[model samples]
Target: MAKPIVSMINVEKWYGANHVIKNCNLNIMEGEFLTLLGPSGCGKTTTLRMISGFELPTSGVIRVEGESVEKKEPYERDVNTVFQNYALFPNMNVFDNVAYGLKVKKVPKDEIAERVNKMLKLVQLDGFGKRRINQMSGGQKQRVAIARALINRPKVLLLDEPLGALDLKLRKQMQIELKRLQRKLGITFVYVTHDQEEALTMSDRIAVINEGVIDQIDVPQKIYNHPATRFVAGFIGESNILDAVVVGRNDTGIQVGTEVGNALGVSDDETIETGDAVSIAVRPEDTLFSQERQPGFSIRGVVKDHVFVGNLVKMMVTLNDGTEFKINRFSEDEMIEPGQVIYLYWEKEKGKVLKTRNLVNTDSHRDIKGGDEDEEEGYAAEA
Candidate 1:
């Protein structure tokens, strides 16, 4: 196995009385894009700061290439950071800003120009060398900042919400550009972001940080489709948490029951036991609505509201237990009116039972053997 490029072993950080990070252990592989993802004040940025050498851990060790870097200065380590605010030197033009690092390192003038031009070209800023920092747009300035950071050829790049300042459109564009740059350069990237969509779109693996601990770490698809915790399921995307009791567990799957109904649940955990309290998650988009009965786990609900949202429709359904859930459907699907009793169903494979610290109460009658054939066919294309 290839050794990890960076490792955090039992890492802890404290700000006087407040514990900012708690017993963190992470391994960043070479050339991988790993994101420390969470909401605001979740310790993600503090973790990033620790790795960049700006803030030392109150306890624990951080290693770079199999050696401890706790006592090293930020510049002494082979890493660079790009912040939300482009942090460019306003006094210098693009060329001078990007070349500042090399000049400080005392690289010869001829070599500095060659390296600077190459970096500019790599960031798609080929001929903007003489442009003033103030004259460039937000995206242009961000590109210049990226070029400046990459000019030094750091083995790792740490970004803390680097796209937060840009408009939505520009941020999306930069996300793709940054992903391409990481792949082409093959440098490990440790990204920090509160945006779930950005993490899902660009990360090779996502380490979801909650409070001061890592909730889960996995590839984007696995993280989205098979969340390991209740927090992971709720944070990565929208989920309808169903509270239930375990009826039985087998090699195939487990059976769970709510106050009003019961359904089959599949768990990644093989240790699920009978009579255990658990919560199952069903994505709103994974739900299908119909007047005719369908097969698989299901529930009967009265449609409370239908909200038109561009190409998507948001539905509010209330079960007999008053457990309300939000379901999403394509706008083209004929709308079901409020006060209408309808069936909501999903396949056995689409539902997940979780054993996190907290369990939710949810109820829906399931008809596992009856479904609309046409609706089943459309599920793949729409979902």
Candidate 2:
């Protein structure tokens, strides 16, 4: 692999008694959309601030392009940040708002005008330059802010939830626009967002941060399909994270015994013994239900409830031994009612075994029986 554009080694930060970031090490390649993703207060924003020079690490080395830059000021670094709230000048028009940075550096008037106009066109705000900052819509204002940041042509752009303040429809629109813009410019983007759907939609790779440490870092598909920790299985998407013990192993796959019965299992590339403790992650989308019991792989469960969510139907089922799993059915597919006994099935390979969740030591599992202990911790719902 080529040298990373940015690298953090053994990064640690503390605010008095509170330890914010703990021994975080990450390498970000050039021109890739890397997201610092987690719930609120998980040190995602803190990490972003450290990278942008708003806050210094208590102990760590932050290198940009192989040069340690902890001593550099924000302006000295070859980067720019776009805040959640559009920090445009209320007194200035769109053109002037996008030209502020160039004016600060005393760039030539003709070049500033040319660059500003070209950026406005690039962001689809060519004729809106004459509009006042207060007069533009929320999305328009955001685009103007982006145009201003890109006018400087920084090596990397740091966006702190820039689409957060928009309405849902506009937020979705901006999400697509932001990803398109990144590819068009071919610049590295370090995005920070608590919205899992937003991160999944825009990030090339996601760094799932928790309690000041990174739990997993991989492409969006791998992060969702093969989560490294139980929290990630629950946090990235809706999952059935069941506590199980390894029962047997073979080339077909390993078998794990749950409270209910022994079921076909899958795991990460780690070695596990017959008596080892593990958790199996089965996504809602991967779950299958049938009226006829599957010979040996199916588990018997009672349907507790079902809800229609647009194009998908979410059904909650509890096993005979009290373990619960949520299965998703398409809106056009067969329907099952509450109190109905059904057999839930899934492919063995779809069940991923996550490593132990002892680092954070908090249950991130969503129980089908209805007690959610992680509610107050700001755990987000996956798309």
Candidate 3:
């Protein structure tokens, strides 16, 4: 098994009276691409800064290679950072910028030239050594920043949304390039980004943070399919969440009485028992719609709207109780119009039953399911 290259145990950070990172625990494996993903002000950038030595935690320990790095300066740590703003020397050419680290160390002039040339080639900027920083495009400048950060031969590379400034097409292209580079170099990468698709495309593992809380950390497929919490389910992808109560256990899994209707869900939480309230998260892609009722699915809804996007279609489904559910299907499938009644169903395994931490109560007859609905503090409810 690969050992963890970086570890954060019970890490917490604060700014004056504001508590930012709260009781965070993470393990970044060696030579793996791990992403810190969240929305704005969710502490993803702050977490990256702490790892890079720009910020210090108020409590807990951060270790690199089994050694404490709390007191180490950014330059002293075995990591290099690439910022979103491409912090290259505007006064110097590409070769000079890439060779800055080697020059600062007073390395032999001959060795510096060789290393700079090789680094530029590794970033696919081989012949642009003599070009000025202002002469490069956004993508080219980002490549230069990466080349500079890597030229130092650091054990780990930290990138804080390095592709954020580029256009959509360029960002997608850079995602593939960055992943390929990380795999080739075999260096641990601690990347920070709020973009879900980017994290899904580039990371070996993704840590989803919300309001300083590390909610879920897992592989892309698992994170998308088997979200451990309600926040993770709605954050990583489009999901149809329904309030449910555990009715009973069966051979396939547990049975749940949801707001829409009775449904079967994969029972992942052993602590949950009959009568306990839970949330059922089913992805839009997993949901199936038909004009007739289907087996194993008892939910009924009316098609409220349909949106066509290139090869896929997004549907807005309103249940009998007036809750809206979203569904995604291929554009090639049979189309259904507004106000048409449709039966919703999915495989038992497709539904993820998550244990909610906090429940909100109201005067309505419907029993509130367990979930944190503190949207004012960075948590949002998904329909």
Please provide TM-scores, in order, for all candidate models, with all chains considered together. Answer: 0.89, 0.90, 0.91
State the RMSD for candidate 2: 6.5
Better of 1 and 2 by lDDT: 1
- Number of the predicted model whose TM-score against the real structure is largest: 3
Per candidate, the number of residue pairs that clash is 14, 0, 0
lDDT of 3 by residue, 188-247 (tens): 999999999999999998888878887777789978987877778888988988878788
**Alpha-carbon runs more than 4 Å astray in model 1:** 290-298, 358-383
lDDT of 1 by residue, 1-383 (tens): 54588888778998989987877778888889999899999899999998899989998888888889977899889899999998999999999999999999999999999999999999999999999999999999999999999999998999999999999999999999999999999999999999999999999988887778777777899889998767788899899887777887877777787764677768877656787667788898987667765654457789999888898989998987998978887873566889998887677767789764421111111111122356434432332
Poorest stretch of ten by lDDT in candidate 3: 359-368
Cα displacement (angstroms), candidate 2, residue 98, comes to 1.0
Query: What TM value does model 2 have?
Result: 0.90
Tens digit of lDDT per residue, candidate 2, span 1-383?
Answer: 44478888778999999999988778888899999999999999999999899999999998888888877999988889999998889999999999999999999999999999999999999898889988999999999999999999998899998999999999999999999999999999999999999999999888898888787788899888877777788899789877677777778787877776556767764556676666778888898878777744657899898888898888888898887788887873566878988887778898886434423211112111111345412232210
Clash list (residue pairs), candidate 3: none
lDDT of 3: 0.85
Ranking by TM-score: 3, 2, 1
